[model samples]
Target: MQIELLVFIVMLGAFLLGNFLLKLPVSISMIMGAVLGALVAGEGFPLRHLFEGTFVYIDTILIISTAMIFMKVIEKSGAMEALNVTIVKRFHKIPAVMLIMLMLMIMFPGMITGSSTAAVLSAGSIVAPVLLLMGIPAPQTGAILAIGSIMGMAAPPVNIPAMLIAGGVDMPYIGFEGPLLFLTIPGAIFTVLFIGMRYCKNLNYDEIIKNLNFNMNAKHGFKLYLPILTVLTLMVLTRVLPTAIPNLGMPLIFMLGSIVGMFTGEKLDFISTVKDAMNTTVPVLGKLMGVGMFIQIMTLTGVRGYIVISCLGLSTVLLYVAIATVMPAFGAVSSYGAASVLGVPFLLALLSGNQIIVAAALSFICSLGDLMPPTALAGNYAAQIVNERYFKVLRYCLIPFTACIIFGIICLIYSKNLSFLV
Candidate 1:
């Protein structure tokens, strides 16, 4: 094997050894990989590069921190409880409406940030209790949140995976919204509907309604969600109405929302909530830091280039199986990493057809990495929020995961008919 590819093998081995044998935290395992890569690069510990690599995703780190604070504030302020009670009562009889609304609510954060962890930890944390109360098993709850969050990340306006693939091939991010939406929406609807039908009959509406914990005496019942509304409105104004409002990025917007939220009903401990948010973000931040180092090394050593060239020689039949397997399985590391490493090569290999279908199909496959094992960030985090084993969550995730891959493959095989996708 080439030196780059050999180093990559050592990196994976070190990572696994650290995680399973040494019993380190997940971030430390990733850091172990980076350390191995750096040593293999013969740089003798490049301190500056290691430090710089940690901050490569500072924006995403900030978003995760602030969004968790927003969620915690709502929890402390009683807004979350109030909103859930109202939603439960409103959708009590209609299981479909309950399922769809809950999924959409869980998905809202991902829609804005294009980050699955954000969706799961923030909105997923809020809805998880309700799902549990409705008798959805913990694994199923985690799976539902994870599936919904991935759908949101794959959808229009802020799809990071699609953006990565599109940017890789010099395709405009615009005009892709339609095709990507088609890739995600149907799967999302099916996931929620199936879960709801399976579990909704167990919901004890009367007990849930009777136990409303928050004092709902505020004249503006809907306005209690102003903090959340503010964040959403700011995100919309920044992206959709750029001329009218300065684009205060996600972290700042979430901070402002948290501050505004204290005025809603109950007083909140700003410092405590922020600290809690920070605590919640610790693992994610460290993972990013470690992963960043590995990615930096990958870019520097040209392992990504080697993989691209190697994969191009596969037949079309093998190509489909490879794409379906690698993108999601390797996603156990990071979907964005998988996208950057393999997306362009796959896109190039499959270029005998329409760009839109190929791009969406590639994104769809990459998006599945959100649920893939090891570092399946979305499902793992959802498991954390819902207090369940991450692997158990993966068990419930199999059906939706299978469905998404099937849809993606069909899109690829029939790309000719999908010219309308453009």
Candidate 2:
């Protein structure tokens, strides 16, 4: 075996052993993988290289951390809830419209958090009971929230997979919004309308609307919403004006947004919210740093290069098939993990004449990992909220999940010619 391949196998074994045998946390398991690779590769177990690897993805780590904090603050401040309630009131009379809105609302949390689990626990939980009462089958309803959250996580503004893929090539975050929006918007519509279609027919549209009449009283609803608006406006300004506004970047933008969020209705308890934010943020950041170490080992050992060259050896047809197959399957572990581990190699191997669409397509595929099993974060969380088994939820997710992969493949096949989309 190639030295890189040998090290990779050993590291993977270390990861599994640490997780299953020693019962270590994911971050610690990854560190153990790094240690194993170092031992086998004759790196002499240098702490410097390990620390170096951990900081390789520092920018993404910061973004993920700050964004999680911003999300926690928004959730705690009652802004997200207020926003959800506000959206419900507009279309409560029209059941299908309300469902559409509800799906979008669920997606928003994921879009903002770049986490399907957050969406499921936040908006998905909020809507589950409502949808259940509408007589939607538990499986289909779970599927709806799953698809929506997946697409939302893959959506433009803060897509972690996109950031990872783009970082591989040193691409700027600009211009992803357009291609990603194209991928996710169509996904949201197709899944909701199709998966939700059956559930809509039996729902008493008028009755659901009447019950959605509950309104939240914010001191100033618009002012309460200013933080979200600030974040969006700053994002757009950075993209459109570029040089006009100093680019504070995502972390700073998130921090600023969190600050503005404090003034929202029922002033959020800052200490508790920050404590809550850090509670969730630290673990994710730790896992990311661990992945960074794994990636660093790959870089040092030429494993990433080996993988890229291996992909390059394959025919175009085989390459796409393999890429599509492995991405979602690996998602059973973690989407970000799949994206960073495979996406970089794919980026090197599959240069389809157009960089933007390929990146977007890859990110879209990786995002759907939430629909697959084992970890099936989005589906399991949605299933829990709906009181259904995850596999049952996955059963309903099959068509839409598979459909997204096919759609992404088609997009890749035509990526070069789809510049009109951007």
Candidate 3:
């Protein structure tokens, strides 16, 4: 028990120091925590253990890296820019139609990219000016971007973290695609629309018209759509298609897409593209390495087991609250942090076949941290683009976020296949 308490304190101290004192990214902080925990726990900071643990996260790094490269190639090719232009021109005359379409456009990329920042940076630039000109307040515009971008993160193909957690639970990766689309997609759409509609209610038609006139010309043409198509096709082939064809995974799909994207256009500069892709890939790998180390350290110190056991003793409602509150702290540090620290052990404990209610409840609640404040990176990026305060956007998100958590818990309770802990 003393060892467990010491480990817990060391882990928490590392988290605080990294997040507040050092101002390091949450993933780095997690790595720090793991290293510190290993040292303090008398494991003597084994280099081999750290290296092996870092190797475990390579899969995650590869997925994010390739996806980032693919996105960068798409962006540079001017395909994304053209798509934005097309969207704005088509919807310029109809505010309500434009809003819905824009929401979908942002959401689609997020689903594919799995990076809320990518979603906003890709879609928000185009949409921001339109909203600004239309008389939408900066805060409201930010709220729209934040909410729409979040919807994308919760969607399919690109939600790698969700896939990882689901995979950890012994659930097939593809199996979760269906549940996410059916349950989480609606939840995301409703959440975005709810916030958007409330803000849109007071706007005048003239104000909306004014926003429509702000430059709809594409810097480039629809030729760029090819890369986007390549990504989508690869996603379908790897995620939706059967393994009967042979080896297919997200990394291979991205590599193929990058190759195709390079040759498809007039320039055909494969060498530079690959180099650029590598540059983007490295930092992402570093981040995942840190996260993986954190998970390894937690396992070493036994805090994960303690937390799971402690959670098991709580009632369902209390369990939900505990998870919801604690997850944000980890999540704020890094999504991967939440995944490693809470997700792995939580899943392990729940999978004991004795705590399905709590397992499902925790899984559902964990996703909400992506939108929670202080470290709500998704919301922060959206706010930056639209010029809204972070807290304001978070306030609008409160209800929908809460609802999803509640619905997820109820789903777990009612799921016939899930066993309850009591």
Candidate 4:
């Protein structure tokens, strides 16, 4: 009968009702949840808290918006296509290596945008025909894209889930690159090899090449990739040189890359590309805003404190079990929601471990929610790209998905030992 627990239930019920019954966008559902939770707690709308919550992820919104614009530039400019073709051409003889490289390529946009849907739609679309040509089953190909895209969403430089958890705990979004790269790079390699390597062993260079969009590579060659290189170089320079180069934040960095991209490949209609990018990005930006409001309300109503305290009472064993199971299951709503709702409290519960590493691992686990049903954004899109039912893809993902959860738990348990990553 605790008011905090009641408020939490009301919010969750409202979210599910809005999301499932009303078929509202996840962001809008979250807003409904927030509004209802406030009402239940007798906070009476609290416009100030709701508006304040929206700004919680303002920086993340900027980064994702600009990053999507950058992704659109690369896609439109032929940079993405050229890179995909180049990778296959270079590594096709070694099917396993080629598959791994292609998987990493699929992860690229998600890594930048912190969205598995971005990865699945952008790189996954391009890679699907190649995988099919390599003789991988459609279901497995979908699984590969789903898993890789999720890993990319969990990767460093723009991990939204990690940012949410860190923000929840008042931790700065620094020192995460090492832990995130540690988890995602190896995780991506494993998922690709596990799902696609055996099927890809019998190489089909001729067919894959036939399907490859080679026009971009032939037209612009290396220049087609300059924008990607420019952004990566800037990222590295800002990190490696620190004082030498100004730290252009992710938004500025992405914008700089987009600007450089305009001249390096096929010409782009600047206004259309920007408009298209914004159109695609607005929903996700709205989701983050909703998450901010949802969490802000949770904090205001003592629901956040209730969850944290409840978690603190559990044994470590139960904590890990809940994290591995419930966290991903929550992704049916939205992975970002799972992070803000559960990941923060879990991180607090596991404070005995290294925070950055634990946060990274938690984010990885939360990213699996993108593969969960209904709103399985990555899985659904990946399935569509490969012409497979998402359930079939989910069946194929069983082993790799379990492995990822296990690896994430291992990261959580031995976080201090893995401090070398930081």
In terms of lDDT, which candidate is strongest? 4
What lDDT score goes with residue 161 in model 3? 57
Give candidate 1's whole-model lDDT: 0.78
* Model 1 pairs whose backbones collide: none
Better of 1 and 2 by TM-score: 2
Q: If candidate 2 were superposed on the true structure by all CA atoms, what would the RMSD be?
A: 2.1
Candidate ranking (TM-score, best to worst)? 4, 2, 3, 1
lDDT of each: 0.78, 0.80, 0.64, 0.91
Instruction: Specify the poorest-scoring 10-residue window by lDDT in model 4.
Output: 198-207
Q: Write the per-residue lDDT of candidate 1 for residues 1-422, one digit (tens) a residue.
A: 57988888988888888876887876788777877777896766777777777776665567667766776776677776677667777898887788888888787767655678877877787788888877788888888999999998777656666766776677776667678878888888899887656878767887666655546535447768898789878866786788888878767887898888888867777898878867866775677677667666666667667777778888889999988898888787677666766787898888887887788878878988988776688988898988889999888889889999989988988887888876
Candidate 2: tens digits of C-alpha lDDT, residues 176-288? 88889889988888888888766666566566556542444444556767788889999889877988888888999999999998876556788888788778667667777
Q: Give every collision pair in model 3.
A: none
Ten-residue stretch with the least lDDT total in model 1? 211-220
What is the Cα-based lDDT of residue 371 in candidate 4?
A: 88
- Model 3 per-residue lDDT tens digits across residues 89-120: 67656656666776777776567666666677
* Regions of model 1 farther than 4 Å from truth: 109-122, 132-139, 152-181, 201-204, 214-220, 347-364, 374-393, 411-422
Task: Judging by TM-score, tell me the better candidate of 1 and 4.
Answer: 4
